[model samples]
Target chain A: DVKVTQSSRYLVKRTGEKVFLECVQDMDHENMFWYRQDPGLGLRLIYFSYDVKMKEKGDIPEGYSVSREKKERFSLILESASTNQTSMYLCASTSGPAEKPQHFGDGTRLSIL
Target chain B: AQTVTQSQPEMSVQEAETVTLSCTYDTSESNYYLFWYKQPPSRQMILVIRQEAYKQQNATENRFSVNFQKAAKSFSLKISDSQLGDTAMYFCAFEGGGSNYKLTFGKGTLLTVNP
Candidate 1:
């Protein structure tokens, strides 16, 4: 079984504050992704890393960035947290095969006040 | 660009009954993969079933099966003998072939099982 672990299950931050959401995968998958899920909007990709130090912007990349310094860890950074940034964030990892399904973490429910 | 659509926002079914969730996608690529993912409340998303465009046969996983129509770009999931544990948000996703492993997901259908 694959294990994808997020640093926090729930978080709260004040407006204009910087926040970090971390994720780690035990399977050493080459691809890691960050997504924000909203009601009636589905899961929109924020950022993805195909390899260490390589990142690509997804559909909704504004106000957010990502880091992949190591093979097993991927981090999402919120430059300036706002009320609208409050949502459920998910991290997923998958191996080399393009057809393989992404394994997801439990997700972090972020609240920005 | 690829896009997935789940027209039904919510669906319900009684225990021991069957329910179907519809999904449609728009893609110019011929080779791709389709997936159904289940995300229970406060739980991680898990893959329910998958289908390959090249394969003509529908994909099934135990009580869950998919009706895959490649030409129409339609893929729907059918759950038989639904149980309480089946209540969750179901997302239909698409992945194009090659090195790009990005998945385009639909808005998702919230399915509730009544006991």
Candidate 2:
């Protein structure tokens, strides 16, 4: 079984503060993704990393950045957290094959005050 | 650009009953894949079933199955003998063939199963 672990299951941050969400996968998958889930909006991609030091913007990338210094870890950075940024964040990883299904972490419920 | 649509926002079914969740997608690519993901209140997304465009046979996993129509670009999920554990938000997703592995997901359908 593949295991994807998120560093925090829940987080609280104040407005204009910097926030970091960390994710690690034991499967050594080549692809890692960050997504935010909001009510009625479902899950929207924030950023994705295909390999170490390689990142790509997804549908909604504003105010967010990603780091992939190693193959097993991917981090999502919120430049300046706001109340609107409060939502559930998910991290997923999958093997190189496009047909493979992604394995997701438990997700971090972020709250910005 | 590829987009997935789940017209039904919420659905309910009694235990031991069957329920179907509809999903439709628009894509120009002929080779692609479709998926049904289940996210319970636990907030963990789990893959329920998958269908490949090239395959005519519908994909099934236990009590869950998909009705895939290639020409219509329709893929619906059917859950039989639904249980309380089956209650969750179901998302329809699409993945294009070749290099791009990113999945485009629908807004999702919240399914509730009553005992």
Candidate 3:
């Protein structure tokens, strides 16, 4: 089975602080994604990396950035955490295409105070 | 751009009963894929089923079956003999087949199964 692991299951940060969310996949998938899920809105993509050092902005990419320095690790960076940034963060990896099902890590529930 | 819609925001069913979740999408492309993903309380996303636009027959896995209408762009999931473990948030997603592997997901339906 494919395993996608996130660095933290839950996190607490103060406003104006920087935060990092890490994710690693054992399957060496070529595509990795970061999304923030909110209550009325579905999973909106924040950023995605197709290959090492390759990144693309998704529908909602503001105040957030991503890093893919290695094949197995993808990191989401919050430039300046705010109360509004508190939400569940999900990381997913896919071997090739979106047609193939993505394996998601247990999400990180972030709280910014 | 493609959009997925789940008309029902919440649903409930008694254990051992049957329930259906509706999903519809709008896409200009003819070739794409649809999927039903379940996220339980554990917050882990699990793929329940998938359907290709070219195939007419619905996809089924154990107790989960999908009613795929390509022309209507409607793909609904029917869960038979629902169990307590079946309670979760179900999301309907669409993937335009090609180099772009981005998935467009619905707002999701929160389903409850009472014993």
Candidate 4:
């Protein structure tokens, strides 16, 4: 089985603070993704990296950025956390083609007060 | 751009009964893929089933199956002999052939299995 691990499951941050969310996958998948899961809106992609040091913006990438220093690790950075940024964050990794279902980590439920 | 729609916000089924979750999508692309993902409370999300646009036969996994209507752009999941463990938020997703890496997901349907 594939294991995708997120650094934190439950996180609390204050407004205007900078936040970092870490994700590491054991399977060494080539593709890694960061998504924001919210009520009614579902999961919207924040950023995705096809390979190490290569990143592409997804549908919702406004206040977020990503870094992939290693193939197994992907990080999501919130430049300035706000109350509206409070939501569940999901990390997924996939190998080869898009037809293959992505392996997801246990999500991080972030709360910005 | 592709869009997935799960009209039912919430649904319930009795144990050992059958239930269906409706999913509709809109896309101009001829070739694509559809997926159903399950997210259980406090657990990792997993893929429930998948269907390719070209395949005529519905995809089935154990007691879970999909009803795929290509013309109508409909894909519905049917769970036979449902179990309580099936309770979760079911999300219908679409992956276009041109952009296989990205997926468009629906709002999700919350299904509860009762004893």
lDDT of 4 by residue, A1-113 (tens): 99999999999999999999999999879989998999888899899998999999999999998899999999999999999999999999998575678999999999999
Docking class of 3: medium
Runs in model 4 with CA error above 4 Å? Answer: none
Q: Which lDDT tens digits does candidate 1 get at residues B1-115?
A: 8999999999999999999999999999989999999999867899999898999999989999999988898999999999999999999999988635889999999999999
Tens-digit lDDT track of model 4 for B31-56: 88999999998668899999999999
Question: A1-113 in candidate 2: lDDT tens per residue?
Answer: 99999999989999999999999999989999999998888889999999999999999999999999999999999999999999999999999665579999999999999
Deviation from native of the Cα of residue B12 in model 4, angstroms: 0.4
Model 3 chain A weakest lDDT span, ten residues long: A93-102
**Model 1 interface RMSD over true interface Cα atoms:** 1.1
TM-score of 4: 0.98
Model 4 chain B, poorest ten-residue lDDT window? B95-104
Candidates' lDDT values, in order? 0.94, 0.94, 0.94, 0.93
How would you encode candidate 2's per-residue C-alpha lDDT over B19-115 as one tens digit per residue? 9999999999999989999999888999999888999999999999999999999999999999999999999999889635898999999999999
Which 10-residue window of candidate 3 chain B scores lowest in summed lDDT?
B95-104
| TM-score for candidate 2 | 0.98
